[model samples]
Target: MTYCLALKMNEGMVFASDSRTNAGVDQISSFKKMRTYNNGTDRVIVTLTSGNLSITQSVVNLIEQRANDPDVPNVWNAKSLFDVATLFGECLREVRKETAAYLDQTKVDMGVNFIVGGQVAGEPQRLFLIYSEGNFIEATEETPFFQIGETKYGKPVLDRFMQPETTLVNAIKCALVSLDSTVRSNISVGLPIDLVSVKPNQFEFNSQYHITEDDAYFSHISTSWREGLTTLFDGLPAPDGFESNTQAAVTESAQPLGTPVAQTSTQHSQTLTPASVNASVAPVQPSSTQTEAESSSQDNQSSAPTTSLMHAAQNNQPAQRSPAVAANQQNTK
Candidate 1:
């Protein structure tokens, strides 16, 4: 599992990814998922990858190997960021095709995804998401971010907050928070994040960070965001019908014993409360007008009704008194 994302904002671009990779529960490891290809003068391209490590690595290696080859077009010499994405997409497809025959026999996933972005000397900064099938899409103002691998856990914050006009500083912060959210919710994603920022038309990385567990700023962000959410949640008003339900319970408890109460469909379906359980099993007493023998007979009747009531509660049926009590009442009538 992995989490890699890129934000294409008006201020610039932000790229980030978790380093943790796991083949199995016992086989966890860390590898940098963010890669940079730059000549430091003409072009600076950043690639963030997720999926089968072998496939992603092979795609990257193939790009780097052919980078200096005079016969072929490569990332460095590509005229635009779109061309660069096409090149990456081609490499990804080639790698998967080469290994699918061997890996498919064992049902191994050869799926690989990439977030390719940066600036060529003459072009503005841009971002692209290249799919496993070698097709690609460029990020636009309407949807200015792309995420691959374990994206769901971290996507809410991004969907709610990220924008093309967002500042670079805030964008980086949002990216870190997004990664933190993913890392916390998912066991497969972990610390030591690789982050890079590029300013428009700079043709070079404006800032880069290697954030680890001990990094103070990231620690603060994670802790403060968590605690702030808790505080915000605590301060929120109760949902609709919640207070009414609570008040109903309070009112129900204050009612006199043996008083009839209207039960909602929900209450009827719910498990018995402690008070209800106690009432079901409590001893039944004879009235003052009953004769001594009748009183003694009612005392014996009490035990049978208590047992019957318990079964009635379990089966969600109305409790019934013992047949003996009904017979005695009938005789008195």
Candidate 2:
């Protein structure tokens, strides 16, 4: 598994990818997931890759070999970013065709996902996400970013922070924050990250960084993010009575995100104090009888009131029988 992300902003584009590769816990290794091909004067292309490294490496080598040959269409001579994206897809298809059958026999997959972006002279900068099948979708204004490989852990920060109008350095910071989120949560993604930035029409990289565990800035990002989350959690107002009772509160129970915070609340969720519960219970409900028996006697009563009583009961409170309920029970008796 890997984590690679690209942000296409109005200022330009920002990209980040981790370097860890592994077949298993013992087979861990480091390899670059980013490839840059540029002439500096007329064209620039950067690609971040995930999935089978062999397939991607082969595809990249093929593109480079063809670019230098001059006898074939390449990034250097491509008419636009669209044309270059087509070339990238074609290269992936070629590599897949060559390796697919043999790998299939071994039940091994040949999937390789790519995020390719850059500019060609006289054309606007563009970004694309190329799948293992060589087809892709371009980044649009609505979603000016693309991510590939072990993407979920880092996506929340990007969804929260990134936008086309975001500044280049700010986008870079968000990318690092996203990477930190993934690197800490998943063992398959380790670091020594590669990051690149480009400004529109620049035709070359504007900033390139290789961040390792020891790098001060990256270390700060990782430390600060964890600390910030800790602080945020500590500062939140917990549900009433959650902190006071140690064993029987939320910490001791199995709960999901959708459940209400205060389990023992009724009366429209606001009146949940133990004293209120007792006061509400003692006055209206009589002992040694089912509330349902009394409710049945008041069949002519409107369902709206009975529904309200049941709703409160389901909220872990005593069901309050109204005056009509007591009169109904008397008539039934």
Candidate 3:
């Protein structure tokens, strides 16, 4: 498995991916998950892929072959980013068609995902997520980022930090932080990471870097993020009223209020205490109980000549009654 993230920002775009694949415990290996194609001044396209390394490689080979072909409409000839994406989808489909039969014979799964993003002359930068079936979707203003493979563990941070208007540097920083989170939580994704940044209207991409284990910027973010999280966790207040007698109190709190309180277990007696709030054993009949309480309080109000129902209604703690009851009382008055 792998993790790839691409972001389309106002100022530019950012793409990142991890480079790890494993067939089994004994067959773990690293391969670059990012591939970039540049036509000098006309366009620059980056493809980040995950799943089924064979299929991904075949797709990349097909794309390169098409680009090199004089007769084919390749990345260089594509009129817009949309056309480029369609070309990629076509390439993926062709690869699948060519390899599916052999891979099926070998019983190897033919799964692959590609995140293709770049700019072509005369159009804004665009990003596309091409699926195994050759269908694709582009990023939009509302949803400005796309992530492929092992995405869930790293999504929350992006959802919180990424925005269409975010600066390119900050967006790249956020992407690295996101990768840091995923790498810590999952083993399938690891360094070295491929990072690419593309600025708007610039036909070529800038700031492409390989982040290995010893990369200073990445190491600083990873270490500092972990330390910051640790400090934050340490700074959070402990559960309220749990400083002493916590286990006993929690256990007692779990029991029904009307149920007989049993002796605290010796193992937890020192830490356990009864909860201040009692639990309700029976279902609360909101209508009947509230009506009875209201009627008894009304009787008290009637007995006190000075305290009128009107005055009681004016008070902050007016008698608790349902809307139906209040309507009935008003009709009678």
TM-score each candidate: 0.76, 0.74, 0.73
lDDT of 3 by residue, 1-333 (tens): 999999999999999999999888788899999998886798889999998998889888888888888788888788887887888788888888887888899888887899999888788899999888989999998999999989998899889888898999999999999999999899888898999999987867779889999999999998998899888887775554345432333544455433333323322323322243244332333578889998998765534234346767778545455555667899999
Ranking by TM-score: 1, 2, 3
Candidate 1: tens digits of C-alpha lDDT, residues 1-333: 999999989899999999999999999999999999877788889999999999999998999998879689898779988999989988888888888899999999888899999888887888899999999998888999999999999999999899987999999999999999999999999989999998876767889999988999999999999999998877776543235323433343244333234433324444545346434332334457667777777677556544477888889988775677678899999
Task: Score each candidate by Cα lDDT.
Answer: 0.85, 0.85, 0.83
Candidate 2 or 1, higher TM-score: 1
TM-score of 3: 0.73
Alpha-carbon RMSD to native, per candidate: 9.5, 12.3, 17.7
Segments of candidate 2 deviating more than 4 angstroms: 240-333
The parts of candidate 1 lying over 4 Å away from their true place are 240-298, 301-333
Alpha-carbon RMSD, candidate 2:
12.3
